[model samples]
Target: MAGSRTRRSSRTRTTSLTDHLKLPDGYGRPPEQAGPQGLDLARRLRALTGVDEDLLAWVWYERSKYTALGGVVLGTSVIAAFSMWNFVNEAIGEASVLALLPAVVWLLFVLNLDRWLIAPQPNAKRRPGPLLMRLAVALLLGTVIAEPLVLRIFQTAVEERIQEDRHGDVDRLRGNLLRCNPDPSQPDHGTPAGCGSYLLSFGATPGGQSTELDALRKDAAALQKRVDQDSHALEALDTEVREECRQLIRNASSGLLQRTSECLRLRDKAAEYRSTHHTAENERRLVRMNDRIGQDGSRLTRSRGTFLTARNAEITQRVAQERAKQKGIGVLERMQALEALTADHTALFVGVWMVRLLFVLIDVLPVLVKFMSHENSYDRLLSARSNSAVKVHSAAVHAMERESMADLEIKQEVTDQYVRRRKAESVAAHREHVAAMNIRERQTVDSLEEELRRPSTV
Candidate 1:
């Protein structure tokens, strides 16, 4: 009885294990046993509940948005990556080193925020609070994780500011080299090669840190001093030019006034000439002379007036011409002087502006150089952040790939199994029908043989 009980218990365990192994076949083994009503009800059920359908549609939309957002984020990150690589390329020169941090940070922020915002989860629960709380927690976690990176970002910014200040000095020196006191003797310092400053500044060997930086500092200071000197000289020149321009303007004003007086005199003289040369009075006098030709003291008076008027007109015209000539000379002289003054003033102002720009550029060069050339703690931090984002993106992609493969495999296996089972059933049915026909044929053959064996009375 004990052995029997053991055997029965073993059977039961085996049965249980078998049941466990037989997972739901999904389809094709047998239709689920159901009452007619149950079957009808199942058939009547909507493919999707309204709310579920809407939610699913929303999810689809969200998925599309998420995909697009992810692509944008990834694209931005790729650009940042290329930018970082470019920074590495320019490592020899400080021109664009500091340019990497902001781009990296921005790319990270976008990628992280998008991922955090769209992280998938079991969304069966409708209550917004738990889901929101979960999302908030995730965001907080992401931020916490990203805190060191943020610090690095801030440090990069500060370092950039410092480097910019230093770069300004370098630029100032460069400007001085180009301008006054330029050593035409010195050969041009060829443009620095790739982003080598970082490698040079932070190499495997720890030698002469202070000495190097101090030298850099000294060079910057010298450049700054020179910039200040140039700026001051430029300012003085500007002031002097302004004063000279003002004096010139005053002189032009005096000349302009004299020209105006001459012009007025010329206008008056021309008017007098026009008045004296009256054709109407002359014509009237001629008419009287003709009418009284033989005996006319009246005709004699008119002729004398006409001769005096012609002489007055000639004298007035000569004076007007002289006055106009004087006025034209004065106007030309004033205009020429005024134009020279304006040109000189313009050139002076332009010179001052150019000098100021050079000073400003010199002052910022060091800082720009430092930020652009060297890797701060932020670069590592941002790199880590980028790696994390990449991992997440990669995991998602792998998961999707796995799911697609699994789906295809399942479909193929189901189709193959179904086809094999259908072929087996068809073969069994054909074999049974063939057997039945053979049995009938054998019985007919047996009847014919028996008849042939029997004796024939006729």
Candidate 2:
């Protein structure tokens, strides 16, 4: 009997629990059933994305959430990997560790970037703020990161163009060299004046000059030497004539009283010698020498100045050409070459940005298509079904709570009634027991009195 009572209590508790938790049938299913066409579309989307049907019904009612997520993951990965590769290449020997830290941080940032694309939906209708912000960031990053790589991709073409430019420079330099030394027969031809045999030295006998220049220089030097000798000769003659003439005058004056013919003849001889050597003849010769010297000196000065100026100019031009040739094919040099070859900096700028824009558009395509597409019939049905399920679940919980409260009130009333009755019964029994005790006490007292009276009779 005890075992049977225990089993009965356990069964009652289980029944109550089930009744409390159970919901109405067909609560989660749609009130109006979907046709075959609607079901077919849902099935196709499920197969394509591989999302669970229940999860699709709840969160991704309009589109394939799985496909969208997969695309974002793939694109982000590709972009991150490409960016990291370029960073490593640039910083490998310089600051490998420092470069890697930023690359890792960027990778993490990009991987979690889907949050910006997907998180703004309070409902299906409002546009997401994060989506716009993300697209702008993507475009900027693409431009900065992709430009150098694109330039590198076309390096072969750039190098070829640089070669062509180099050849042009060399040809121009050679032409300038020819202009500096025009004579084909001379050793200076086809060479710069600084390096040519004709302009190796300067002065009366400068090297590597034409025959006419050499003759002119020699004539100028000879005239200069002859003029120096003539000047010294003229000075000596003047001094000798002055001394002889003074001596003649002194002799003639001393013998004035005698009036001798010898003195007179000596004076005449002095006068004749002075006139022959120091007067008109020598003076005329000196004047002629001066004129010739002046003419030759000026001619030589003009010729020398013209030649040196031309030669110096040619030397400067040649030096500049050599430096241009020596400019190596390094990164900075290559960039300069590219600029020179293209010539239009504005066009290059526009082209680089256009490439970046294309990449940004490609990266954001899947996100835009998924979010911007219109909701279909299957989505509406799924949303309705989910709403109905939620309502039924809520109703079941409320009903269970109300029933529990009512049952608790009835149990409380029954317990109170039973307690009152039991109290009343106990009070009545106590009153009767008190009355009986009083009666017993009175009888015992009477018996004691009668016994005392009988004892007296004995």
Candidate 3:
């Protein structure tokens, strides 16, 4: 009865061990049995979430939650793709199929990036160094991804700002051109201050037509001087004649109101000088010169008008050309416009940063979620299984080594035995061959001896 009791107690212990070694409730169960909703999708999306679905299968019913996380990762990739497409399009200043390649590349890169960032979990203890590094990388990627979306959100405003900048550029160009291409004759146009650096010189202007006018003015001045001198000489002569004829002064020797010889001689000489050179012809010549100057001045004014008109037309053309260059509104331009828009307004600055932070958080969600989570049922199971596998592998390797060593010893013993047997057999064979040769030699000697003993044959 005591022996039977011991046997029963051993059986009970065996049953307890079996029970303890059995799998958990979820393990070995079909995915469909996980919940009312199957885990089929959760299994597939495990690749996106960077979680092992096979390991996660035995976990608590977090399939739904992880599936949603996987969806979030996918959504982030889509957002990155869309943002990249727009970024390329905006940079080129147009939409084209060529932008699709980069968009697809970015999508894959971001998908993989999120997976890498979220997938790797510490075996037992969470190391902050690696986690922090991953978080930093995710934040950097998120920051890079946010700009394009932000630009898209403020697209209308940015476009308006770009247009304003374009117009401003055109205005500045026009002002510079006008300044640099000043009308030479019009001093009021002033110097083109600081315009040389910008290369704002416009127009192929001709020299002014003021040469003839200037020459005519010089001639007029000379003629007027001559006419004045002639008139002054005539007036002086007339005043002397009046003084002698009207008795205002008399010769000191003649005290009478008689006509003085000297006065008469002077009057005669003045009349001769006037007859030879009169002021009337000189006055007429001066008048003709004045008229010629006026005509030349009018011609020069007309030429100046033509030059100014052509110069203005060239300036307009230049301004249009400059505006054409400014028409390309690219990604950089939009970013600048957004920056300018946000610089002054406090509310807008806050709103812009908030949107950017929201996008960053969205990108960082997968990492953050996994980081905050403790080791789940799957992790524990994987750890236990991993330890078990290591022990089994080590044992197998040790067994293989022992088996190999035994095999080598057996082979070595067999080879040594074979060599010893072969050596003995060869020794025996050599001795037998030597003995046979000696017997043959003895037989010949004995035969010769018998022949010699038997006499006759030489």
Best by TM-score: 3
- Candidate ranking under TM-score, highest first, comes to 3, 2, 1
The sequence of per-residue lDDT tens digits that candidate 3 reaches over residues 1-458 is 44455446556765665466565655754656545544566566766976665566556476677778788889888989998999999889899999999999999999998987777453656889988998999899998899999999889988988888888988887777767777666545556568764443434432444655666788899889877887788789888888877764555787755776767877997888776776677788888889888887777787788778877777788877787788678888888888998996778788899999999998888888888888877667768767765775676566556666777787899999999999999999999999999999999999999987885765
lDDT of each: 0.43, 0.56, 0.78
**Can you write out model 1's per-residue Cα lDDT over 1-458, one digit (the tens) per residue?**
44455446556765665465333432211245222335432222211111122222212333233334344435434543454444333332334556567557755664454444333322233356754664454444334333223222333333444445445645553343233221111235233334232111111211233334344455555555555565565555555544444442223645542223444454555445435654345445545544443333343345435534543454445445544443222222332433344365786446434544443333232222322333433233334445655765676566556666777787899999999999999999999999999999999999999999999998
Residue-level lDDT of model 2, residues 1-458, one tens digit each, is 44455446556765675465444443333444232336554344334333334434434433445545555555654676566655554434233556666667766565555434543232244346855766666556555555445546556766787778777876666565546545432444454546353333323322334444455556656655655565566556555555544543324546543433554555566566555545455555556666665675566566656665766676666667676655556555555665654565667656655765666665565456546666644445445555655776676656556666777787899999999999999999999999999999999999999987785553
Q: What's the residue-level lDDT of 149 in candidate 2?
A: 56
Per-residue error (Å), model 1, residue 203: 93
Give candidate 3's total backbone clashes.
0
TM-scores of the models, in the given order?
0.22, 0.37, 0.72
* Worst 10-residue lDDT window, candidate 3: 199-208
Candidate 2 ranges with C-alpha deviation above 4 Å: 1-73, 92-109, 115-122, 126-343, 377-458
Name model 1 segments beyond 4 Å from true: 1-352, 355-373, 399-407, 439-458
Please tell me which predicted candidate would have the highest lDDT against the true structure: 3
Q: What local lDDT does model 1 show for residue 274? A: 39
**Candidate 2: clashing pairs of residues:** 198-207, 198-208
